[model samples]
Target: MSYRNTGTLFTVLVFLFATAGARAWAGSQSKLVAFTVDSVLAADTNKGIDVRIASMGARLRKVFSYTTYRLISRQRRRTQCGRMTGFDLPGGRILHVEPRTVVGDTIGMELVLFQGPRPVMTTELRLKRHAVLMIGGPHYEQGMLIIAITVDTPGSHDVLVHEPRIHQHQRLHAVSTPGQAP
Candidate 1:
């Protein structure tokens, strides 16, 4: 074959290889959108000591999708704790004085957050089997929690951790400090 013909063939091969590589990395964009609504809050409450409270409700839906490109064998895979927050409200707190209680194998996961007004928060945690999802409380202004999990399979897996129901309630009250009047 002529030099020009050889060069053309090489270019075509290179293009195909590059395109394949990109597609492999992205998995499937359409699939990803399927598993996108991981979690949602259907009920929330924000109440102060004044006996006044505001309430809200929310819904969490599946928000992500994945497909196996090569399966990577059927080996057991583990994932570290993964956590993401959708909101970080200031001056808000989580009202849970009781220590966390773990009942059974699948009955010990609780997360709650409260905001004053015009603000809300959401979080998402994607994990595999035998993994733990740790949820801390709102500390200072930007306190956060952690979620740890492990994947038991190597094939493509999708997880949707959603509440599908949340009600938010909050009360308005003036901050109490030294030299402050009610």
Candidate 2:
């Protein structure tokens, strides 16, 4: 082959190899995610917690007196691995969450709840896309406190709740999942 033709062939081979390497590297990188934090309260009732949450409508009414109890608050946050965010909730409670690891469609997170800088509760959660994690009361009267965390992803409907009444509450809603539309 002529020297010029040989050189052209070498250049084309190098370009193809470089492009393949770049695509491999890009495929290995973790995907970024965004999540939202919501805090809500309901009047403490004699009905079982399952019954109460099942009946909870799309719009929650403020039955408990905020003035008498702790203030209710909501905040939106966006974060990636190694980053942390905080949300303030009713009854002087603050929630701190950090994403520890993200693999494929699963996210590993650390969640901590604090009452005035004192850590009241801490837990780890692995959430899938479009999933929600709800944490309920530490109970005031018949009133219950709910803290919900949801990820922004399409068709990812997984709901996990960690609280004292979760088992009993799970039994009530057989047809609908916690995060799914009721």
Q: Which one is best on lDDT?
A: 2
Clash-forming residue pairs, model 2: 43-143, 44-142, 44-143, 45-142
> Which regions of candidate 2 deviate over 4 angstroms?
1-31, 44-72, 140-142, 153-169, 172-182
lDDT of each: 0.27, 0.59
lDDT string, candidate 2, 1-182, tens digits: 99999999999999999999887655433344566676655443333233334323322222222212222445667765666778877777888888776666778889999987899899988886545676765553335576767654323454433222222222234353332112
**Cα lDDT of model 1 by residue, 98-164, tens digit:** 1122212121212334455432344433333333332223233222221112222223353433233
The list of candidate 1 runs beyond 4 A from truth reads 28-130, 137-182
Lowest-sum lDDT 10-residue window in model 1: 64-73
Model 1 lDDT on a 0 to 1 scale: 0.27
